[model samples]
Target chain A: MTGNFFYFLTFLTLFAAIGVVVSKNPVYSVLFMILTFFALTGHYILLNAQFLAAVNFIVYMGAIMVLFLFVIMFLNMREDTEQHKPVLSKIAAAIAGGILFVVMIAALKDVNTQMTTTAVFDSQIGMVENLGKVLFRDYLLPFELASVLFLAAMAGAVMLGKREPGEQNRF
Target chain B: MSSASNAYFTNVFIMNDIPEVIRTIPLNYYLYFSTALFCIGIIGVLTRRNAIIIFMCIELMLNSVNLLLTAFSSYRSDPNGQIFVFFIMAVAAAEVAVGLAIIVMIYRNVRSTDINILNKLKW
Candidate 1:
């Protein structure tokens, strides 16, 4: 039953990911990327990481994808505005990626059969209460630093997006 | 291909004393799936000309990593992996904000989003 769900979600996720790549229109790509995020959220839920699932839904599908769509729309990109790379290069890229996948699979195929021995599974481990407790305890420093990173990013974005002095036209 | 993955799947899934949820799907399956997704992202990055699409593909790659981390977290019953995922998400958001701003700035200057045109730095 769960295996079926995994297969279905994996199919949805990979299909949407490919759609994001192959779609000529950036708008379509953004939409497809949203679909991919949705499937990933489903995967998170299936893994019982409900907190991360919610975060993935809110942040990736909600915030980040919307930003991508806004930029694409703001720029007013059309399907034909961007041209594809030459066939030779596209094929080369595909070949390279395929080789990478093959290499990774071959290397990690064994990867310690001892991992199957398994640890004690705590269903509550993924709950927000536990995750937050851990976040504030063991990972407190990184949590605080993440806020600092957000602040810097916000400031930098504003400065970068701001029009320069005496500029003729604005974005 | 099916036979190989099936063999690997049985190898990983059969011997585990993991809880029902974690045992339902093999850990090796997650590894293979995420690896495929990551490779797809790489292909998108290498093939696409639009800077924004390339940026999106980069996000895809980041997401694949996040998925793998979450799977490991669950299989090991560890919250620390999920905590790392939170940090990754935070950093990813910041990255997108700053990266999109940079792309916008570049677009403003060049009047185009094609990465090929911004090759003035190439020597």
Candidate 2:
């Protein structure tokens, strides 16, 4: 049952991910990405990482994707008129993607046999209490650093979004 | 072939009698699937021409990594992976903010989001 569930979720996740890449409309791409995130969240839940699944929804679907949709709506991008790139580029991309997939599969071939029997960890470990302990102990510095980066990114976004002084005509 | 069947039957017995193994299988499978998804995302970013699409592809890639991290944390009897995932989430949020701001600026200046058209930096 678990194997079948995972197989279904994996297929959905892959399909949505591919849709994000192939969709012509930016809005559709973002929407498909949201679908991908939803499937990923299901995978997380199946993994017994319930907290991560909730965070995945809150962060990706609730925050980032909504922002993407707003941006797409705000921009109102017209359809592309330029001829699609040559067929060679598309073929090359397919080949490159195929090669990458093959390489990753080859790298994991050794581990496949060893991993046939799944190893179970304590469920309590994935709960909020345990997560908090590690976050405050070992990973605190990087956590703080990430916050500082966010602050800087916020300031940079504001600066970038605002029009420069003396750049526009005054009424 | 008998050995394989024995292992399968043994696993079935263990899974039925011991639920822990059943739970673990899903996590392992998710980790493997997420890794594959991440590879696809990398390929998309490397090959795509539309700047907006490229940015979306990067998001796809980031999410894939996040999935793997989440799975590993659950598998290792440690929540550190989850915490790390939180940090990654924060970073992804900030990245989108800055990335979209830049994209907006580019659109204003070039009136197009085609990456190939932005050749001013080309020597």
The A-chain TM-scores of all the candidates are 0.95, 0.87
Task: Calculate the i-RMS of every candidate, to one decimal place.
Answer: 3.6, 4.2
- Clashing residue pairs in candidate 2 are none
TM-score of each: 0.92, 0.85
Error of 1 at A160 (Å): 0.3
- Candidate 1: misplaced stretches above 4 Å? A116-119, B1-21
Backbone clashes in candidate 2 total 0
Cα shift from native, residue A95, model 1 (Å): 0.7
Residue lDDT tens for model 2, A1-171: 766777788899999998887777778888899999999888777767667778888988998899888877777764573235677887787788778777876776555322244454356666667777877889889988988998999999999988877666321
DockQ, cand. 1: 0.51
User: In candidate 1, what are the lDDT values of residues A1-171, reduced to their tens digit?
Assistant: 777888999999999999999999999999999999999999999988989999999998899999999999999999989988999999999999999999999998988523444334466788899999999989889988999999999999999999989888854
Itemize residue pairs with steric clashes in candidate 1. none
**CAPRI rating of model 2:** acceptable
lDDT of 2 at B95: 92
Per-residue error for A68 in candidate 2, Å, reads 1.0
